[model samples]
Target: MTIRAYRDADLGAVIDLWRACDLIRPWNPPAHDIAFCRSSGHGELFVAEAEGRIVGTVMAGHDGHRGWIYYVGVDPARRRDGLGTALMAHAESWLARQGVLKVQLLIRETNTAVAAFYERLGYAVEPRLVMAKRLDRGDGQKNA
Candidate 1:
């Protein structure tokens, strides 16, 4: 597979891949997330393609402090073929070029398989709580 930056036309295939990988949640709508990343200009979305198909994707960027990765997904049938690792490597390279010092990503507490995969990539568990407040609810209203 070849790793490359995301394009507008890749939306359908990317969302389908994320769904197949069980990466979508009701609270985090895929289309909104995609638009945010595309416009944020802080991070990049990388997709892996093989046989003219999008097989994997990763969103990575830094905020001038540290780098973060999100929405990492690989096609179920395409797993175990090093596609995820390749995508990550591409992300890291992209971040490093931007002078990012540290890279971090979040894995659901119950996602043991995903945690293991990250561990294999030399990412360790950090003892920190991730707190967040949703600023935009897709309704042009802030949460009260």
Candidate 2:
């Protein structure tokens, strides 16, 4: 598989891969998340291709002091072949190139199965409370 930056045409395939990998959540609309990542120059969406098919994707970006990764997915048929690891390496390289000093990512509370994969990549479980407020609904309107 080959890893590279995302292109406009890859949107559908990427979204499909994410869904197949159980990455989509009702509260987090994929369309809006994709737009937020693509609109700002700080983020990048990387995709993996093999046999001319998109099989994996990772979105990485920096908030100046730290880099964040989201939407990591690999085709179910393509998992266990090191594709996920390679995609992560690519994302880390992209962040490092931008001078990001640290990297972080959030895994859903119920998705504990992926913790081992991340742990193999040297990411440890951190003790911190992740608080959030509704900026708006999925429609992109500001909360009143």
Candidate 3:
């Protein structure tokens, strides 16, 4: 499989891959997330293509100091093939080019497997909690 930047025509397949990997949730609409990433210019979205199909995806960004990774998913059928790692390495390289100092990713506490994946990639779990506030409620306006 080859890793590359996401394309406009890959939306449907990317969404389907996310769904197949059980990465979609009600609160975070995939389409809206994609649109935001594309327009906000805060990060890059990447995909892994195999046999002319999207088999994995990852979104990465940097805010000057540190880099963040999100929406990382590999097709269930293609998990052991290292596509996920390749995607992440690509992200790290991109972020490094942007002068980012550190890279981090958040995995649900219950998702031990995912945590392990990053651990294998030289990421260690920090003694910090992830806090968030929903700024958008999907109506093209910020939440009050």
Instruction: Give candidate 1 misplaced runs (Cα > 4 Å).
Output: 137-144
Report backbone clashes per prediction. Answer: 0, 0, 0
Q: Score every model by TM-score.
A: 0.90, 0.91, 0.89
lDDT of 2 by residue, 76-144 (tens): 998899999999999999999999988999987788889999999999999998776575556665322
Can you write out model 1's per-residue Cα lDDT over 1-144, one digit (the tens) per residue? Answer: 688899999999999999998898887888888888779888899999999999999999888899999988999987898988999999999999989989998877667777888899999999997876676565555322
lDDT tens digits, residue span 53-134, model 3: 9999999987767899999999998887788889999999988888888998888756777787898899998899566656
Better of 1 and 2 by lDDT: 2
> Alpha carbon lDDT of residue 16, candidate 3?
97
Check candidate 2 and list the clashing pairs.
none
C-alpha RMSD of each candidate structure in angstroms: 3.0, 3.3, 3.3
Model number with the top TM-score:
2
Candidate 2's C-alpha runs over 4 A off are 137-144
Model 3 spans > 4 angstroms off: 137-144
